[model samples]
Target chain A: MGQVVLKGINKFYDSVHAVKDVNLQIRDKEFVVFVGPSGCGKTTTLRMIAGLEAISSGDISIDGSVVNGLAPMDRDIAMVFQNYALYPHMSVYDNMAFGLKMRKFTRPEIDRRVRDAADILGIGELLKRKPRQLSGGQRQRVALGRAIVRHPRVFLFDEPLSNLDAKLRVQMRVELKKLHLRLGTTAIYVTHDQVEAMTLGDRVVVMKDGVVQQVGEPLELYNRPANKFVAGFIGSPTMNFATVTVTEANGSLIAENAGLRIRLPDGTARRLRGHIGHKVTLGVRPEDLTVAGAADPDHPCFDAVIEVVEQLGSEILLDMKVGQDVMVASVEPTVRVNVRDKLRLAMRPSSLHVFDVKTEEAI
Target chain B: MIEGAIWRKWAFFYLPMALFLLFLLFPFYWMVITSVRPDGELYRPWNSVNYNPFWTWNPTWDHVRYLFEETLFAAWLWNTMFIALVSTAISLVCGVFAGYALSRLNFPFAGSLGTGIFITYLVPQTLLFIPLAEIIRNYRLGDTPWSLILTYPTFLIPFCTWLMMGYFKAVPKELEECARIDGASRWQAMLYIVIPVAIPGILSAGIFAFTLSWNEFIYALVFLSSPEQKTVPVGVTSELIRGDVFFWGPLMAGALLGSIPVAIAYSFFVEHYVAGLTGSVKG
Candidate 1:
């Protein structure tokens, strides 16, 4: 039973507080991912949980026992590093068998485990080759094999697939998910890629500036971000944000700017009831903004001129100008649009997001 | 690999290479020729007819024979080899540990401490031998193999440590971190992952340390006074020359023979040495 918990864990590097007061509880057989921009403390938090980095305060417990002062070896975990970290001098078999050898496994047991892992990774025939002789994907597989051979209680991955090319990254991501399911071991993955975190994680933790912003399932974080940072960080083509003032008129709410006005839906207006006459940050995802038609006169429509048209085969993304700001809108491929042409775009009322400008928190 | 024309190849690659080789190897050629030239030809004055100083005729082993039989050249060679190897071993052991610590561990003052160790390496050996001589005499290790062996690391360790620190820094820290999470202790991770990956760096450092102690002159001259204890550099210069009379033949023979070990060492690990110098730990 692999269960890892971090209680108010903090890491300080001299005067710089790198990871500040992180608390998490990873359940048995759960796949959790920590994702953030560069220097956002995701990797630092992963290293702290792996016991590679010391916690300046608080405790980390693995399997209900506090491992704060324990060595990484005593923690019973295996990690796949971003560079794979395959032992260059050792053969693939030796690299896979190293942990077993360290634990004093018998020759037969070590052989069995190594061969099983190699077969599982489809690298059985490449066991005799050194790490330098293997391709990048093969090295990645061998790295994975090395971690699996130990059968440790917890597996830590620090941007393992970020080294692979695009197509290979997707293939390996699927394989990693399958491997986790087959092994049924608790795994903690860290990456800067939102797509990787969304696809691979059972639960995703989004961090920014050394603080945990939000943690939830992929769709939850995408559909309901906790703050402006989470809204922008967890989606592709990213959510477009604009500062609009909430003004009460005609017994309803109208979010207004210089060249844009949208009537806030009743549900959204209720949340902004006390914040009238104050400015709020309006967030709209690219896919949530659709082309308005004459029949949609009741919808909140705004005028925008298409600046750049990007046809991505499956969908067409329009970079359009609204007042002084540019926002991207993902539309159906069948919709005909061109640069410098004016269009009326309507935002999905139920999907609209409003954040307090001061706190940048969802209103 | 120079492209375009044949003239460009010769101008850019071959001709310059040939000249550089000649410039580099001329000293060894002179050493080899002078050691073998007969005494009649050796002092034959450059003004003599049929001079041809570059080529020698009627070669003899008399200089080599005298170098071995008359002077304590064999004992000096043995002494030089023993002192160099022992001191290099001691320095490498300490250096590898010190270098790994300075580069990898996040101890207090690690940055300044590394700079401190490197600063010590920059101090000229000429100045260090005086204070060292006093310590050698107080400990009564003077004129013995231990005198040079123990004192050589004083300079060698810092040199080795500095070289190794730069090398260790190039090795990815992820390798050790991965190994530690694989259930290996910190020491095991270093042994299994870091040191093995750093073999080329270690060889280059060892080669550098070996050559430094092998060719060290001032310390050997000041510390060792006996013909039996004197290394090749000190013994050959002091014993082969007497006042105004310079034994050119034996002196050249000693020079030629003394450099063979270092040459062999360089050629033996040339690939790893180059890799070490260039920082081969890419992964």
Candidate 2:
């Protein structure tokens, strides 16, 4: 196992800079995930670390040795591509053993490694079958097994579960987390799925437009996003945003939107002292808003009409319209509601996020 | 109405296909008939009065026997096989490497190199034979099978290289990339992954090179002045025509025999050949 340190890594394709000035330290035995939308250079960063792509400008060191000039083979890294890329002509056993054999390992040693990986992946019966004969999930395991048998210093996975069905993807995600724990090797995974990052990574790096927005533990990023992009990208049923102007109403900081007013919590108000007169964007997650009676004196509240409601057995997603903007609220599944029905909602100030309107930075 | 409509749909599908089959089969039938008939029946218009299309009174094996006995049929066959085999082997070796490079490498002006190879293929052998003949004579390779084997690749390599280039490109790049990461170098990857994956393309390209060298007439006719060194096409056509009195019997007989290997090769890998052609056209 080895730690990877990327210093001032920048990649450019002609005039278009793909990854810009990236510096990160991934500890040994740490699972770090790079998450972003397509073309955000997450995959490019992973590929550069794997030595598959050359760095236009930067230095990459693995276990305290510079590896920018090393070929992929010389770098001693294994990668699992999105398409799996298993050899179609070879059986699962041969596909997994190819890298070991290429490195001149003995036959008995290769067989032992192959059997161990297959047993770990639960694909012992598939050893004799060619890749083409296997299903997508089986091929994915074989691809993973191929990388495992190499026992490289680092494991690079580029959306390895993106091609599987939804249920299989979830199952594989759990398996991958367990596998990382078992191997205790440094793993750098790249994906656009935020849930995967939250579930798998010891540290998650959120990126946008080739720039790292924030890097932190999953809950750290979730609770304290560095910017607007990180805030919106880190959660599903995404955080809701509303334009509001902060005004001091009789000494209490009041955030006023059209047909809505929320009195800021004292701690949140102190953090926004410098931006009292400017327009700010108030952010709240779906699960942070609750259905409360109009006379509930716990926290600030709002009134909204339900536009749509989706019940997912245990929880419900309420699409409610307040004035002009629509926001989702997560509540108990048994909270019976209908379209166009007005309801009172209590907001939790601790869970609320505020960002500067012009800079999109957290305030 | 339902039965008639079903019949109409069946005919709509199979009618064009049946016509295509007959269109292709007619020429082979014509060649076989002409080869078997006597010299007198070479160009006789169909006789309606006798009403005999399948049956010919003077059907004989005279032409076939005369071809063996009169000319250097055996020597020409041997020379053609030798040149075709050598040319095909050399072309494949040169073409596969060039093709892989053109498909995968990102060197300076790689696109222009591919276009340069195809442009070389476009230069007709008939147009090139004069200068090539002079060069061959200067090198003292006149009337030698090596002349054809060496010159055949000038025509064969460019086209075969282009064919295999598109074939290799059609193979998923990730296959080789995965192998490269599996500790195989460029040459090892080509040997273990790219080549095996492109077997069908190479086989079709090989068949093309062989048939081209076999049927080539212009360069063979111009360069080979001796009957002993001439390939099948030049030897058969030149030997069977004596001062405008064409030896129709042995000429058609040799023509028939000369086409056998090409025909068998065509049948052996027809699927791959068609796929190769389609791939090249797209690329």
Candidate 3:
């Protein structure tokens, strides 16, 4: 029943506070991913959970028991490091069997489990080869095979896929999800890639500067971000942000800057009623924008000049100049857009996001 | 290898290489020739007709025979072999453990401790032998092989430790971390995973420690007083040359024979030695 809970987790490296007040409850068989920019304490938190790092003042319980003082071996967990960390001198079979051997399993049982994990990872034929003889992808499989042979209560992944090439990384991501489903083991994965976190995690934890910004399902994080940082971090092409002043007119609120005068929708206006006549930040996602039609008068329309056009086959990305701010619009591939062309774009009312200027938190 | 004219290749690479090889091998060539040369040919004046100092057509086994018969050369060989092997084994065990701990563990003052150990290696043996001789006399180990065996590690352990520290540092820390996470205790992880991965480094350190003790002169010469207890360097030098008259033949013969074991050891583990020196830890 691998349920892991961390309470009041704090880490200090001498005087540098690497991780601050992290509390998380990870349920059985759940694949949770902690993601953020470099030095955001995601890896530190994972290491703490693995019992690899000492907790300054907190409790980490695994399988309903406090493991704060236990060694990593007693934690009954396996980890896949970024570099694979395969034993250079040992063959693949030996590498996979090491953990089982350490745990004092019988020789035949160790062999059977090693081969089973090898077969699962499609590395049975590579059992006799050393790590130096295997390709990057094959070595990665061996590392995974080594971890799976133990049947540990929890699996810790520290940017395991970051070392693979782009094509291989995508391929392994699907395999990892499938492996989690097959084993039904609790896993905590850490990475800096937002897409990986969004795709693989049952619940994604977004962090910034040693603090967790938000924790939710992938779509929830994308749809309703807690702060401007989450909104900008969780999506590709980055949500465009403009520091605009909110003004009330005609019993509504309008957020406007040097180039944008967007009439806030009722939902956004009601939330911003107290925010009116104050400095606020306006946020809009690229995919929520489309070419405005004459009949769509209810939609908020704004004028922008296309500075560059990127044809991505599946979609056309227009880098547009909106007043004094630059924004990216992921438009339909069929749209015939050119550089320096003035176009009117509309924002879906429900998709508009407003954040506080000072706190950078969503309003 | 110079990618240009033929003359450039010859001048830049081949000529210099040939000169370097000649310079390096000339001493060994002289030793071998002198050891085998007849007593008359060696004693002949250089200005005499057909001096032929480089090559001796009349080669005899008299020098080698005298070396074995007239001196305690066999006993010296046995003493040197036993002392070098035991001391090297002792130093290797201490070095590997000290190096692994200093490089990997998170103990307080680990960095300073490592530096301090390395600084011990820098102390000259010449000065160290004076105090060591006093200790040897007090322990009543003055004329025994134990004196040299016990004292050799003073320098050898530090040398081996310093060499091993650099090698252990090159090994990635993730391998041990993964092993620990895989169920091995810290000590088990070191023994099974880290030590095995560092075999090349160990071999290199062992070979160096072995050679260092084998060729060590100051401590061996000072500590061993008995003719039978003396090592090769001391035995060959003291017993062979009777006061002012030097036994060049047996001395050369002894030098030539003394180097064979170290040469064989080097050739045996040449690949690992090179790899260890390069200190590359493949991920």
Highest TM-score model number: 3
Q: Write the per-residue lDDT of candidate 2 for residues A116-234, one digit (tens) a residue.
A: 99999999999999887899899999999999998999999999999999999999999999999999989999999999999999999999999999999999999999888999999
Task: List residue ranges in candidate 2 displaced over 4 A.
Answer: A294-296, B1-6, B9-11, B39-54, B57-59, B271-283
Over the stretch B92-157, how does candidate 3's per-residue lDDT look in tens digits?
Answer: 999999998888998999899988988988999999999999999999999999998899999888
Q: Local distance difference test, per candidate?
A: 0.92, 0.88, 0.93
Give the per-residue lDDT of model 1 (tens digit) for A25-63: 999999999999999999999888888888899899999
DockQ of each: 0.70, 0.46, 0.90
Q: Where does the lowest 10-residue lDDT sum fall in candidate 3 chain A?
A: A292-301
Q: Give i-RMS (Å) per prediction.
A: 1.2, 4.3, 0.7
Which candidate order results from sorting by DockQ in descending order?
A: 3, 1, 2
For residue B122, what is the lDDT in candidate 3?
Answer: 90
> What is the per-residue lDDT of model 3 for residues A68-116, given as tens digits with 9 covering 90 to 100?
9999999999999999999998999989999998899999999999988
Estimate, for each residue in B170-212, the C-alpha lDDT of model 1 and write its tens digit.
Answer: 9988888877777788899989889989899999999999999
DockQ, prediction 1: 0.70
